[model samples]
Target chain A: MRGAVMYAPGDVRVEEREDARLVEPTDAVLRLSAACVCGSDLWPYRGIEPVGGATPMGHEYVGVVEQVGGAVKGISPGQFVVGSFFASDNTCEICRSGYQPSCPYSVIMGSIGTQAELVRVPHADGTLVPTPAMPPADMIPGLLAASDVLGTGWFGAVAAEVGPGKAVAVVGDGAVGLLAVLAAKQLGAERIIAMSRHEPRQRLAREFGASDIVTERGNEGVTRVHELTGGFGAHSVVEAVGTQESMMQAIRSARPGGHVGYVGVAHDVSLPGVELFFSHVHLHGGPAPVRRFLPELIDRIWKREIDPGKVFDLELPLDQAAEAYRAMDERRAIKALLTP
Target chain B: MRGAVMYAPGDVRVEEREDARLVEPTDAVLRLSAACVCGSDLWPYRGIEPVGGATPMGHEYVGVVEQVGGAVKGISPGQFVVGSFFASDNTCEICRSGYQPSCPYSVIMGSIGTQAELVRVPHADGTLVPTPAMPPADMIPGLLAASDVLGTGWFGAVAAEVGPGKAVAVVGDGAVGLLAVLAAKQLGAERIIAMSRHEPRQRLAREFGASDIVTERGNEGVTRVHELTGGFGAHSVVEAVGTQESMMQAIRSARPGGHVGYVGVAHDVSLPGVELFFSHVHLHGGPAPVRRFLPELIDRIWKREIDPGKVFDLELPLDQAAEAYRAMDERRAIKALLTP
Candidate 1:
């Protein structure tokens, strides 16, 4: 088997690795059909987040179950499935409340690296959702998107309480942000504003149901949103880029009593309490509970109701993993799809 | 008219002030029945918040309408009313959404100083909710509580999403925190945990329906809450003290995906984004939309179903306002009522 490994910042290589095997009785070994480079991957690739020596890369994946341990009852070998990046037993109080990211018995599948030919998924019965059947070959990218990005964006929208007749503003133009636009649209937001300066991403944003596009950043972007929403800011604002500026922009871009759903993995950001206290906004976000939305997301994708896969602009064979990382890291591609 | 004025930190004086008169067409002049020294007043008194000049102090009041401007249609002279500390038009989009504190035309009643014989209330028709009729003397204290502390505490509980079968933890033992326990009970919480170290406040908390009391602070307090809830923390945590430690404690005391309703006037606090992100908690709070809850709260008080006013541990005449402030500032009283 071959897997992508990050030896240092900006250095990624695909090398022959030992085959993945089920470690726990509740685990399942997956022969990955497709994997992708996530926007979060750029954090370490840019050296902003520490790259521990020889780290296994990738968490987003879609694959067919190759083998299952004795205790895996719901998932079986040969079934095509999409699993959340965070594995959870799904029966805990946290998981039942739809916060699998912090589930007491949760496991991070990222530690096992999904950008490989085979990977072990823990708590298979709870973390993986099977497709109705073998998804058509062309549907792989979209299902793979459901593994992380699509579900993440969906969570952002849901956290913002996006609903019919809402005016939504999305910060950041990365794949997650773009998909949030799609999620807001699906959630019935009446007006969608995508904040982006990139023309290509702007076009894609519009295609994904953005009613308007504001190229400004920070305060200027907030002002644009207010102007577009009759000076009340947006009813719901999604923060997909985890930064002080983006978070503040999202907060300022909402109407008093509006919601700011931030899904960005906050880095060196510290929110001033006084401002948040007086902003009169509802704030909720974190690493998304992707597993909670996987079944619905898969159903939507299976019915061709949404095309989240369009976020992928570059596709490569698994062996060219280095090129895939570079393209995404350099912003040359919104997302890079890798086929194992 | 005599009103409480803060000339400097720890320097409060009851001085003869100009007569209160209607200003805006929506204004109403009220002959204050009662006013109170709030926990927030101690902020400036303690010199933690700046006292730029001789500022009039106090916002909580239940009064009889002495006069009303021509445009005041909903409220009239001779009506005994319970008004929110924040005057809101209550017709704006934000107000209709139940966030009167951030209404575009909202006015802070504290600036005019309700701790006086008379005061002018703006947006009277919207800010003041009349009691069913003139209440008996015993109900005066409770109705006055509804003016601010009760409403603020209720907002905290509501923001924390307190409801049946939920575990609620209140972080501040102040008047507002005590009343939040009352609010959580009214909202049907199955278990109410009041976090307090004071013996008197703990007794008051129990009277207000606190099922348990934890006397620890900071991390130890969080651990105690976890121990109380099978290590999952409280489902709803109300934060009533505005400080870094209290805010962090409230957040830490809630389970993942739990609610933290904070109502303290934040002085200086900064939340680490990374910690909040990983905490997986939902945060919503601000100045209490007291006007939004005034009607329901007043009704409960009128029916004698709740005794929120039990939080008032001291009462003084209008001229003894300085003593009232001193007692509350010194933590000798949970709250002080001033009869003007």
Candidate 2:
């Protein structure tokens, strides 16, 4: 089976790999139908996040189950399914609390690499949620998105407490931030503000239910958000860019007693305790428990209620994996979907 | 009027001051019945927090209204009242949202020095909550506690979401943290864990409804909390010590999806953003919106339902304000109440 592998910084190659087989009684082998290059992938590809050696790439997938081990139940072969980046035994106490990413026996599916022809998924019954049926070909992109980004954006909005009458501010123009605007809108936020400097991304943001757009970054952006909300900052802020500046902007953009839902993969960010203490905002985020939102997201996608796949502005054949990485790294594409 | 003034670090003097008079149309002059030395006062008295010059001190007070400005309605002369350290116009949007400390027109009562014979309170009607009746002499300590420590503790518990069946861990054994145990118990937390090494404070914590006491501090304390909670941390953590170590300990002691309510006056603390992002804990706090909880807290004290005043272990005449600060700073007393 062919899969993406990175031997070093900026080195992504698609080559033949050993066949995946059942490793545990609860494991299932999935034949990939769709996969994508994640923004987080750039962390290692850009050498910002260290890569030990030829590391397996990708953690997002939507595929058809090809085989299942003896202990795997509920999920069966031939069913199309969406799974989170983290494989969790959904029956654990943490999973029951809707925090599957912190499941006691959770495993990072990225280490196993999902952007391949075949992959072994541990804890199949708990990690994978089947679509109502084999989704139509047109629904594949959105279904694949539910594997990570859509669920992540949904989690961000929920964490931010985006609800009716809330003025929400999203601090990032990436696919997740754009999708957060959609999520906030779906969750009934009265107003949504998307921060983006690019004309194209701003257009998509507006299309995805953004009621306002602010191009400024950092403190200026927070000022604009405050100006938009009558000197009180936004009621809910979704921070999808995990940088020191972005996190601070999100925190500062929220009104006292507001919420800052941050989903960006933070690196080298340290928040001043006194400022955060006086901010009087609720801060909640992490690698989102995508599995917790998969069921509902899949249902919404199946019903054609939301088209999160719009985030994928570029698509590529699985063989063009290197180009996908290059395009996304250079900011030529918001996200690139790959068909295996 | 005589007020406590800090001429220098470790140099506190009770000196005659200009008479207190209404300064704003919404202001009221109050003759302080009781004022106490706070843990935060030690920061400046011990020279940890810088003192600009001869600064007036103290913010916590339970007093009798002596005069009211024209616009100060509802709170009239002769009314016995309890108010927050921060005086807020409760009618503002921020105050209405239950974050009075961040109210646009909020005023720090410390600037007027509550540790005085008489002091002016701004936004009187909004800041002062009248008791059901004049609290009895025995209840004075408890009512005074409500003016700051008890109210701060209640806010911490509420912010941490300490409710039925939750395990709550309090990170400080100061008056506020001890009161938080009582608040958690009153809020129905099934288990309250107080982190304290001092036997007396630990005893007070247990009396305030602490079900367990952990003598360890920092990471070891966090490990202990996790061990107690079956490898998962506490469901709610109240951080009443605003230092880097205490903040991190509080954050590390909460389970994923748990809440950390911190209310200590932060000095030089800073939180690492990456760890916080991945911690998946909800962080909420500030100078507690004590005014928001004043009415209910007062009512509870009126009914003799809580004995928060027990935290004040020393009593002194207002003239001995210097000794009061010295006693608290030297840890000779948990808290010292001053009678003007």
Candidate 3:
């Protein structure tokens, strides 16, 4: 099997790797149909996060189950499925309560990188959601989006309590943020303000239901959000960028009693407790329980109600995996889909 | 009028002050019936927070409406009332959203000092909630508790989303935390765990509906909480101590997808964003929009359904205001009542 691996910062390669095999009866071997580089992958690629030595890359994936373990009850071979980045036995208390990432039996799926031709998924029945029927080829990317980004963005919107009549503000221009805008719109938000400096991202943000755009950054951006929200701030704000500046902006851009749903993985960030206390906003977000939303998202994608696949502006063959990483790192592409 | 003033840290005095008078059409003068020392006041008194020169102290009070400015409606002179520490117009969007402390027309009543014979309250019509009838002398302390501590504790419980079948943990033994235990019980929490080491406070917590007690602090305390909740954590946690240790304990004590409602005035706290992000708990708190719960709290106090006044362990004449502050500051008293 061919898989992408990163040896060091700015060094990603596609190479032949050992075949993925099942070690547990609850596991399923998948022949991944589609996989993509995630924003978080840039953490190590840009040297911001350490590449622990030839680490396998990619977590988001959608594929057909090539083999299933005896213990897997709900999933079987020949069915296309979407699984969460975190494998959880969905029947656990935490998973039942809709926080699968924190499930005691959960396993981080990134360790079994899906950027390969074959991937082994554990807790198959609880972690994978099968589509009602096999979809057309064009819907593959959208189905893949449901595996992580779309579910994550949907979780962000729900965490922020975006609902009818809410004025939402998104603090990042990444795929997740743009999708969050779409999610807020779908969740019945009355208005959405996307904060993006890039023209291409701004246009996509608008198409994703952003009613307004603010090109400013930092304090100025927060001030613009306040002004746009009648000096009260937005009713809901989604933070997709993990930087300190983005987190503060998200917090400051929400009105008192509003919510700030941050999906960004925080790095070297320390929030001043005084400011957060005085902000009087509800804060909720973390590693999204993507498994919880896979079914609904798959349904929406199957019905063609949403086109999250548009985020993949660049697609490359498995052999061109390095180029895919470069394109996304250099901002030449929003996201890159890989086909084996 | 006479008021309690802190000339410097540990140097409080009872001094003659100007008679309370309305400065705006929205102001009202109240003849305070009672006032009490708060744990937050100890911050400035013990010097963790600055007592910037002769600062008039105290915000909680139960009083009689002495006079109202021309614009005041809904409240009248001679009416006994209970008001939140933060005076708000209550009609603004923020107030309407149940966040009165963040209301644009809000005024910090602490600046005016309710620990006096007479005090001026801004936004009278919106700030003061009249009791059903003049309360008997014995009920004064309970009503006074509702003005701030009771309301704050109730808000903390409500913010933590305490309800039937939820396990609640309170992270302070102060009057507010004890009251939160009561609030959680009233909110139908299945089990209330009060985190306190002091024997008297632990006893009071038990009386207030703490089904269990965890005397350990910091990491060990969190361990005890997990052990108690089937190795998970409490469904709800109320943080009434603003220090880093207590904040972390509250966050760590809550299960994933649980809630943490923090109300203690944060002094020098800084939250590690990454840890908070991984905690995956809903966080909500602040100065607590006490006004939001004032009406129901007052009614409960009036009907004698809850005896919040039990938190006040010491009582003294207004002239001994200095001693009242000292007793609460020294932890010799859970709360101290002052009467003119």
Candidate 4:
């Protein structure tokens, strides 16, 4: 089997590796059909974070079950499935409450790494959401998107309570932020404000149902949102960049008693308690519990109701894993899908 | 008219001042029936906040309208009313969206000082909620409570989403915290845990429907809450204190995907962005839009269903305003009520 591994910053290589096998009774072997590079992957690729010995890469994937352990009841071989970044028992109290990311028995599938020809999925029965049948080739990208970005964006919109009659502002123009515009529209938000300086990303935002666009950055962008909202700011703001500037912009763009749903992987950002206290904005975010939305997202993709895959501006063969990482890290591609 | 004025830290004087008169078309002059010292008043009294000359003291009040401006249609002379610390127009978009504390034409009623025989309330139509044909003599305490602490506590409960089947943890044991226990009960929370060390406050919490009490402070209190909830934090946490420890404890006491509603007047508290980002807890707080809850609260009090005023442990004549402030500041009383 071949997998994506990083030896150091800005260094990605596809190397032959031992094939994954069922080491636990609840684990199942999966042959990945599709995988992708994530925005968070750039943190280490750009040398912003520490990278030591060879580290397995990628956490998002959709695949076909090849072999299953006896304990896996509902999921079986030949089934098409989508799984989240973290594997959970789903029977735990936290999973029952729909917080699979913090599941007590959770395991980071990233350690096993999805960007490979074969991988072991732990707690298969609970971690994987099986599609009704084999999806068409055209549905691959959209389903793969649901494995992480789309589902995370949906959670961000839901956390911010974006729904009918809401004026929603998004602070990021990445794959997740673009998908969030689609989710907010699906949830019935009347006004969608997308903040993006990139022409291509802004065009996609418009296609995804953004009612307005603001190219200004930081506090100026917040002021523009207030101007559009009659000086009261939007009802909900989504923070997707995870930087201090982006978070503050999202917070400031919301009206008093509004909600700020931040889905960005917080890196070096810090928030002053006094500012948050006086902002009067509800703050909710973290590593999104994408498993919670996997079922519904797969249904939507299978029906061709939404084309979240449009976020993948570039695609590559699994062997070209290094090029895919470069394209995303250099901002040449919004997202890159790899066919394994 | 005589009012309490703070010349500096630890310097409070009862001095004669000019009587308040109608300043705006929506203004109403009220002969105060009662006023009391509040926890927030200590901000400037203790010199944590700067004070210039003799600053007006007190904001919580229930009073009889002595005069009304021509445009004040909803309230008239001789009407007894209960209003919050801020006077809001209630017609602005923010107010319409239920954040009346940030109303476009809002004014801080505290600046005029309620600890006087007569005070002017602006935006009378939107600011004052007239009592049902004048509350009974004994109900004065209850109505005064509704003016600030009771209404704020209710907002905290609502923000925390306290309801049946949920475990609620309260982070403060002051008048507002005690009242939050009452609000949680009214909202049907199944279990109420009050964090307090004071014997009298703990007793008051029990009387206010606290099903359990934790005497520990900070992290220990959070641990106790987790122990009470089977090692998972409470579903809802109400933060009634504005210190960093209390804020962090409230956030830590809630389960992943839980809600924390904070209402303490923040002085210098700050939250680490990374910690909050990973907590996966929903945070909402600020100066509560108390006007939004005034009608329902007044109705409940008028019907003799809730006696929130039990929090007032000290009663003093209006002339002894200094004593009222001393009782609350010295922690000798949970809250104080003054009669003119």
lDDT tens digits, residues B1-340, model 4? Answer: 9888889877877789898999888899999988888888877877888988889888998989999999988898889999989999998878887888888788998888998888999999999999989778899999999999999999999999999989999999998999999999999999999999999999999998999999998889899999999898999999998988899999999999899999998767877777888788999988888899999999999998999989989998878877777777889999888786
Q: What is the C-alpha RMSD of each candidate to the true structure, in Å?
A: 0.7, 0.8, 0.7, 1.2
Query: Tens digits of per-residue lDDT for model 4 on A24-47?
Result: 889999999999999988888889
lDDT (tens digit, per residue) of candidate 1 on B88-134: 99998889999998888889988889989999999998899998899
- Which pairs clash in the backbone of model 2? none
TM-score of 2: 0.99
Instruction: Provide the overall lDDT of each model, using Cα atoms, as 2-decimal numbers.
Output: 0.94, 0.93, 0.93, 0.90
* Best model per DockQ: 1
When 1 and 4 are scored with TM-score, the better candidate is 1
For every model in order, the TM-score on chain A comes to 0.99, 0.99, 0.99, 0.99
- Candidate 4 stretches greater than 4 Å from native: none
Estimate the lDDT of model 3.
0.93
Instruction: Give the clash count for each candidate.
Output: 0, 0, 0, 2
Ten contiguous residues minimizing lDDT sum, candidate 3 chain B: B44-53
Q: Write the per-residue lDDT of candidate 1 for residues A1-340, one digit (tens) a residue.
A: 9999999999999998888997899999999999999989889999999988998889998999999999998999999999999999999999999999899998887788999999999999999999999999889999999999999999999999999999999999999999999999999999999999999999999999999999999898988999999888999999999999999999999999999999999999999999999999999999999999999999999999999999999999999999999988878999999999
Runs in model 2 deviating more than 4 A are: none
Ranking by lDDT: 1, 2, 3, 4
